[model samples]
Target: MTQSPASPLPSPEERRRLREAASLTQAQVAARVGVSRETVRAWENGRTTPRGQRREAYAHLLASLAEETAEETAEETAEKSAQQSAQESTEETEAQNATGGRDMTVGQGARERADTAVRTAVPAADPTEVEAPPPEARAERPLSPAQAFDALYAFCAPALVRQTYLLTGRRELARESVERAFELAWQRWPEVACDPDPAGWVRATAYDFALSPWHRFRPRYRHPEPPPSNASDRALLNVLLELTPPQRRALLLYDGVGLDLPETAAETEATTPATANRLLNARAAVAARLPDLSDPTELHYRLVELASTERLRAAKPAVVRDGSERRARFWTRAAIAFTVALIGTTALTLRTAPTQYEPPVPPGETVLGVPPRVAPGPLSEKEQKLRAKLRAQMQHGPERLAPQPE
Candidate 1:
């Protein structure tokens, strides 16, 4: 028996054309196809191909949709030609889809990393933080490492700098934090690229760096930079800085950067409930001081506007790469020096070590045989007379001996 060949499915372009022609949204297509909208978008944009069950379901959906679109197109052909309304209708639907896509806010791919981490750790998702991306996979060629890094930096750096600035009320710190994060990203490009969300990785690094307490100790950042020229912005920043770092981070990630509660939690390394509390407390604090920012939406817009007060430009890709390499080299040299010093110290210790042990001297003590002293007795009479005679006469021993000899 011969095996039956599987039925053919439409091309990616055909798939997209059919959907557009039918005025179907990606979310609608995804729902019918048993997948997420991103997955459907990826497929339509030809970034990936559906597989196994998803592939089968997608193929069927496309085939059915294609047949329907064909019939509709034929019926509408005369009317469309007469009114030249086909293009207009397609354009309107495309515009609608574009608007819908923009609503996803900050690439979910990156937010898959954190409240907008690296997507600033990552770029942020503040609906107001960064502009919504257009359709994914508009290009056929995969981005080179350099290209990808540059593209990500250009798209997310400014927004992240803004987000980081809001997180930490220092302009220099905000810029440095972002640059350092990108430098780290460049160093770990392989891991970052392979990560599910590269932007989030960079963003998380940026956020963590920005929120670090160590930054304040740095001489350069020990003092606060000049606040925004606008008194309102300056006051708002001061109010934001007043919140504890955790609370401040939660607020910035959630309200300022547009990261959802869960993403904020992940980025901030807190539980969902804790994150929610932080948000509430932070929001309340801001509202008490600045009533205009009571609403999260308003707060987000305000944060964006405040960020515009300071223009943050990230280091170029080449500069970041160089900095990363320099750091790597410095660490490498430090490690080598440490190892060498340890070896030398060990060698010196071995060389100077004592070869033999000597016992300590014993304490002195009295001798058992030593005689004891007694009081002197009176001299004998004869001895006394001799002594008195010797004392009275001055006698020379040599003269006396010579006289005796003569």
Candidate 2:
């Protein structure tokens, strides 16, 4: 009988995408599968492949997670579509009503005015005189704060997440950073809305979070899609990965995110000159690696598009239901309680402890005993001659051990 071919294992990229789509961090997935995080990372990086029971477990886990993720995505998409349809319907209704009312009022006034002008001008004017259109009904009113924030969130969140992903090279970390920044913005809407560059504030905050050391200990998730497999793109990504974090961040912010030198510098917390230098070095390094690319701008545009596409796929719409304030309050209360407990414990220990005491010395007596006085005997003749020689040496320079070179 012919042997059946064994089922092929999933590719590393497939595994990574499944893990991320399920929102499971490497550590979390590892724990579920009874493996170390490093092992999971190794599997994802193609350093090693799972086998036997481990392989079975990994496959099963991924299958379940992927299925769940698909279901969730479908549900979310359907809900979003329904909500969007409803919102559009409402907006269309409002627009029609407002337009109808405005047209009725404005059309009558414009017609009357135009007629009056035409009649007056017709008597003395040339036949070629053309009437100007009435000025556009006063420009649409400024957006309210809530409307402005919604607009900003829709425009800025995806790009911010993308820039952060380029900086950190991790999808979940980028998402977390961007989400945290938006949470802060939601909490301080007034301040954020009034800021000169509200998007800048959000981007800077996300960048800071992406660079935070806390991420070192936090579990990591992968991007849903693998990077481009083309030689030039691969070379560029490899060079970028090799660069220092500051250099990578500078390049991404300036080229990928389209931030200016000063803005990039501010986001990276470096001086403008330093940021410019980093960009120059990063570009030179990429060029050296991929000399086939004639135009450097092509690389920048490619990276920007890559990051933007990934972010657009990954970023969810920002909702203002963040519980950050509640978390902050809880931490604050916990700290206060801890401080009070520590203080009370210290006070109680002090109150219950024995007092230190010192014993008094007897009146007119030293605490330590004094040594008995002793009489010295006269020096022997040889000792006296030695002492005399020492005194002579002290009083006058000693004779040279060897004759002076004079």
Candidate 3:
């Protein structure tokens, strides 16, 4: 038996045209097809292709609608051609009567009238037919804070965790980083929501948290082995581990996280030039380690995909206790004031206290002495004669003293 040929897949343009011609919204088609509007948009934008059963259903739907639109278009074209012919004939007769059967000018006047009739008879083209508005333009209103948070979380949390994992190389640490980052975002939704790149802010915050040393002391889940197919990735990861912290962070932020050089520098707390240098050095080092890898983008993407295997199911909502912040601030200020007052009071007391002095003890009243010494009495006649002899020798040369000694 011969195998049946496969049905042709509808092109993106065909899908869009059929939808438009069917007067159906993306939401309507998505509802009928059991997919999200975003999925339908992806198909129309050529970002993704519907596969398996959905593809067949989608093709059949479009083909049926396309056939109906073609039939309708044919009927409309035939009706318009008939009306134009009738109007042209009527105008030619009127022109001939107005020109009094003047052949030369009658033909020209009839032609002008017929053209004007056709222009006036046909309605202006529908704007939707001219060009469909973008998907974002169709939004009824801006998303509420809660809705915005949910959307942003759904879109960004997994990638944030993945980037964090790449930064920290631990699953639980990555989850903590992502949770803490989202917690902060929830606490300050107004600011984060208004930020130009809210997702970037979250990713940067998570990556920074992951790199913090504090996580080392926190409880962590067991690390999973790298996927079996990514053996070379393990080698690349080893090379990355060997790099200095700043170099590794810069490389990961630039390539793995898909941040620009300046943004990466801001997150890493380095200047743009310095960040660029780190990236350059890191790339060179990785290249040296993996000589067989020429282009590292694929490797970077693979690592990111591997890290993103685990998804964050839900974000923990931030909790704020009423008046807690106010109370804390109050206590902080009170403590500071009390400390200052205590220091000031101590200083003032020290300065105002009088110094005690001890009066000098009477010289005659020594603590352990028996009595004062009395002056010596005059020397005897022999002592006086000896003194006079000594004085005579002093007045003479030292030779007189030396003879006395001999």
Candidate 4:
């Protein structure tokens, strides 16, 4: 038996009319939905119907096209109205002038009536507020990348800066990375506008920029050597570094990027929650060795402190010549000099003392033929008193100071 001919699809004539009314070509429609020009022609010619998902998409596209067409017509009508009203107003003013301002009141009244009529028609004709948006019945135009960036910045910059700094560890570097990502988005605006999560793309781009060689080497210094024996924080930092690239990616997605599991999956190109779970588990295995991250509140306070300090540094007000500060510095220098002088004088005094020499006396020098041995004198009263005070003060501990003997 012969197969019956396929049920008729939308006619070429109908499709042509719709496309023409919408001011769209076949190629444009095909480009949007990832089809070829020939396929679009065949569908329009009723040779075949777009199957399954494509048919649904096509129907939606056609509806959108119809709405756009209606909106364009409305816009054209509004433009024509504006032009006509302006011409009439000019003509009326001329006529009033011709009447030598004698009918100025009457002419003004007529013009005011006309102006009111126009004002009432436009929803937001006031000079202060923005012009009223086109009716919602129209298809909304897609935003360009620059426009989207502006809107995103207004909504997200506060949170974004924190998030970025957490990931990149440098405010200036983060800003540069974000700006570069936006520049890339602007260059590929056509593709970017259709992306499901444009912000995610920017985040990824920033991550890549943060890892660039130039950024990695930006710090140039020989740090004082770390104390021997691993600190918990240093150990944890090492563990974090040991993680595989993918594990690091997942952790950052959820923890750093603040993405949920589903978003993490999307960013990592993994399918299923199970896969994402495995990735996260792997990351946790590495991270468990790390010191517990500080509390969020503490971190926030730290950021505030850092930002305020940086701002103060940047502002760098003049260093005032305050009496106390100056005195403290002068005293510090004086104390250092006094210490050096005391040390030098003590050394010189100790070195210059003569060595004691007992000359052996001849037999004639002995008194009453008896040799006299040198006898040691008892300690002086002042020395004995100072020693007693020091001993007492030592017994009493640090609370009391013993004054030196006058």
Local distance difference test values of all predictions, in order: 0.78, 0.72, 0.73, 0.59
Q: Against the true structure, what is each candidate's TM-score?
A: 0.59, 0.48, 0.46, 0.32
Candidate 3 residue pairs in backbone clash: none
Residue-by-residue lDDT tens digits, candidate 4, 1-406: 9954433334567666778787677779888756655467667766557766677677677767767878988977886796578569868877887978656777777678767756655555558775665674378898764567566544444444444444444556655555555556555656766775566676677667754656554563123223214354344434544665556556655554444455566566776565577555655564465324444333234334333332111110111113224555787899999999999999999899777877787675556866698788898999899999999989858875689998
Estimate, for each residue in 122-182, the C-alpha lDDT of model 2 and write its tens digit: 3455658867654543457889766776788788876777777777666777777887887
The clash numbers for all candidates, in the given order, read 31, 0, 0, 0
lDDT of 2 at 71: 88
Model 3 misplaced stretches (Cα beyond 4 Å): 1-135, 219-230, 308-406
* Candidate 4: residue 266 Cα off by (Å): 3.2
- For this target, which candidate reaches the highest lDDT against the unseen true structure? 1
Q: Each candidate: RMSD to true structure?
A: 21.1, 27.9, 17.5, 25.7
**Model 3, span 1-406: residue lDDT tens:** 9955555767888889889888798879988887666568768878667777777777778888889999999978966885778676777767787778667566666667666666665656877788877774586887877778877877887667766666656566777778777776776778998885687778778777777766456554334434325576567667776888788889887777655565677778889889999989988887788876446677576667656554534343322212324455787899999999999999999998878876888675555666666799999999999999999988856853344453
Distance from true location, Cα of 388 in model 3, Å:
63
**Candidate 1, TM-score vs. the true structure?**
0.59
- Cα deviation at 304, candidate 4, in Å, is 14
